[model samples]
Target chain A: MQAGKPILYSYFRSSCSWRVRIALALKSIDYEMVTVNLIKDGGQQFSEEFQALNPMKQVPALKIDGITIGQSLAIIEYLEETRPTPRLLPQDPKKRAHVRMISDLIASGIQPLQNLSVLKQVGQEKQLSWAQQVISSGFNALERILQSTAGKYCVGDEVSMADLCLVPQVANADRYKVDLTPYPTISRINKSLLTLEAFQVSHPCRQPDTPPELRA
Target chain B: MQAGKPILYSYFRSSCSWRVRIALALKSIDYEMVTVNLIKDGGQQFSEEFQALNPMKQVPALKIDGITIGQSLAIIEYLEETRPTPRLLPQDPKKRAHVRMISDLIASGIQPLQNLSVLKQVGQEKQLSWAQQVISSGFNALERILQSTAGKYCVGDEVSMADLCLVPQVANADRYKVDLTPYPTISRINKSLLTLEAFQVSHPCRQPDTPPELRA
Candidate 1:
């Protein structure tokens, strides 16, 4: 929406960042990627400079339309509002709510509980299991809800904002070794999403800053 | 927007439920509050019936406009979209993003990390202190962000969805023994918001399910 390309402060392996990356790509908006190393020296995101950019000290903060905004969904909604093409939200109010529901199920319900900050608090010994429990419970509910709402994507065949939230979170679940077989719908949807160029380019491993060993 | 009065499946002490309650009151949309206890008998929210209603087994699932929507912010957005009168979001795209940003900060950034499930996972001995850290860090960031945005409420004088989210979170911070004196902006905003009838009527203490001893 601004004259120059938007700048996204993101990390290579951050699911939240990947969510916004996919949204930007889906909208075909040009963006400059500014990597925030979340794992280096106890996180560059905590630095005073980045903190000034995002008082929350988190990534996927976008400098677009002359103001910086944090929270991936909020940024996505902003893009949808300011530059709405290949719309990510459905027109019907109820369908729009369903898409938002699926997104929130991942954003608020699952991701934060298993976030790196929370996992560090859980200690290395309990991190995987803690992530597993949160992800599985969320996926179980998502699968049940998606069964009623999904066609090909999370909300019908159209790729909506729900798909943007779903793919990155599914990647995080994979990283934590959460079993996906139980959630056939989620697993299937994720598999289909990965085949798309937008999601492919936005994959964590394909990022410029991804560790060589972790790169796909 | 629906023919009959909407039904909100909520709990007295649930911050998420309180968010929806405040939005409902602010919109002047009449709704029936159906209490779903989150603490009794190991949380009635985990019951088979309640789980069917909300697969996530969380409070603040609203049945309105002939469909049920979960997640407080999603519910509020739905209300804003379907009922445009007395708007909860500013019309400017950037300002709307700012309102959503504040709401997201409280919802995804703070609430989930300190949720009852997360607290239980932290263990009894660590729960309060853990909540304190999570909420304080969040509020500290929130205070900084609000300095530029807040006036009468979060995101200016309009009393947007951000205020609906903020008031309940401040209540939770008090419950966890977080000292609010450090966040003068948040404290001031919360104080001003409480003076409004919508926020007052929807307060946790004023809910029908509030215990006799807890009622104001």
Candidate 2:
């Protein structure tokens, strides 16, 4: 085992990073946070040091067990494997599949289309509309799925990884001014998830590198 | 367990669907293929029946163990959990993290950006260039990560989930005419993976729904 606290390289406003942050908090893993300011200095993630750590040049990359792991879901799954308490994935195989399906719908289907890098490629003039359309379309599908799957949280009331992904994407939807009126289930779950200490403490607004003006 | 063979709802040309197909083949799972042609009839995935199976309206939803699961990675993970033979994930924690990281980099970071839906939204004229650029950028990082992690396959000699994600994506990159010269590692791995029986049988050109003119 690694001697020191695991290091989490994160950006304050990145939804992907926020997902990892919530997982770390939920599992009660003590770790160090190093800010990789995605916007400042033309993205610290592109720097030689950070690039060496994570060739993908994205945050939240975690250093633990003497290895550095990139990709938020991968890192979280590692934690789930090693830690396994206050479990982020459901125990039942089918319930676990629901958690993963919901998580991937947001992570792959929704978030990637509207991320900072993709937005930059989308160009300044069309970014907002592009993000809004992507989020709305994804949420349309998500709302229908959640209507069937949700109880108190995504996948039958368990605070699974699906909830971890849900809250952050809802925050992004809010940022993009997506009309949540059509997604009552999503809105309700986001509201319910926000009340938890793990979610509140690990929120983007509460992060160490969150801009002073944006801090909660 | 379900009495009959598990059903895989798939489109022949979809990279995401191809990932699941490769996994199902690798596990030697007996499955029924139900075609959901994305192009014909304005996307069969949009029909009420398909939407009920997968609200995300994406192909490669799997019906197994009496539950329907969507998202390629989710379905693959469920398969790994249940079957566990000829494992898609490594036994070691760190190695598994490596496999998952590479898989997510392709699945979330790359495939989603250049998917049929995103390309349609990108508009007809710019689709080729948009896909080329996205695939090239993502492959740059993937090549670097693979250089470090690869043995006979991504994360080691084992044909892990990372390989399942890689072959389909490299096929996508080829479809967009992205130059593979800069990514020798990826090119070599793709060449090697193509020799495998599972990859061969699961290929897009070999799919049941593949157009007659496109069939291998």
- Chain B only: TM-score of model 2: 0.98
Per-residue lDDT for B76-140 in model 1, tens only? 99999998878999999888999999999999999999898888878999999999999999999
Q: Against the true structure, what is each candidate's TM-score?
A: 0.98, 0.98
TM-score of chain B of each: 0.97, 0.98
Worst 10 residues of 1 chain A by lDDT: A1-10
lDDT of 2 by residue, B1-216 (tens): 678999999988999999999999998999999999999999899999998889889988999988999999999999999998989999999999999999999999999999988899889999999999999989989999999999988878989999999999999988899999999999999999999999999999998889999998
Question: What's the C-alpha lDDT at position A63 in model 1?
Answer: 100
Kindly list the interface RMSD, in angstroms, of each predicted candidate in the order they appear.
Answer: 0.6, 0.7
- What's each prediction's clash count? 0, 0
Model 2 lDDT, residue B207, Cα: 86
Each model's DockQ? 0.89, 0.91
Q: Which regions of candidate 1 fall more than 4 Å away from where they truly are?
A: A1-3, B1-3
Q: Considering the true interface contacts (CA pairs under 8 Å between chains A and B), give the fraction that model 1 also has.
A: 0.82
Model 2 quality (TM-score): 0.98
Sorted into a CAPRI-style docking class, model 2 comes out as: high
Interface RMSD of 1: 0.6
Q: For model 1, what is the error of residue A139's alpha carbon versus the real structure, in angstroms, after optimal superposition? A: 0.7
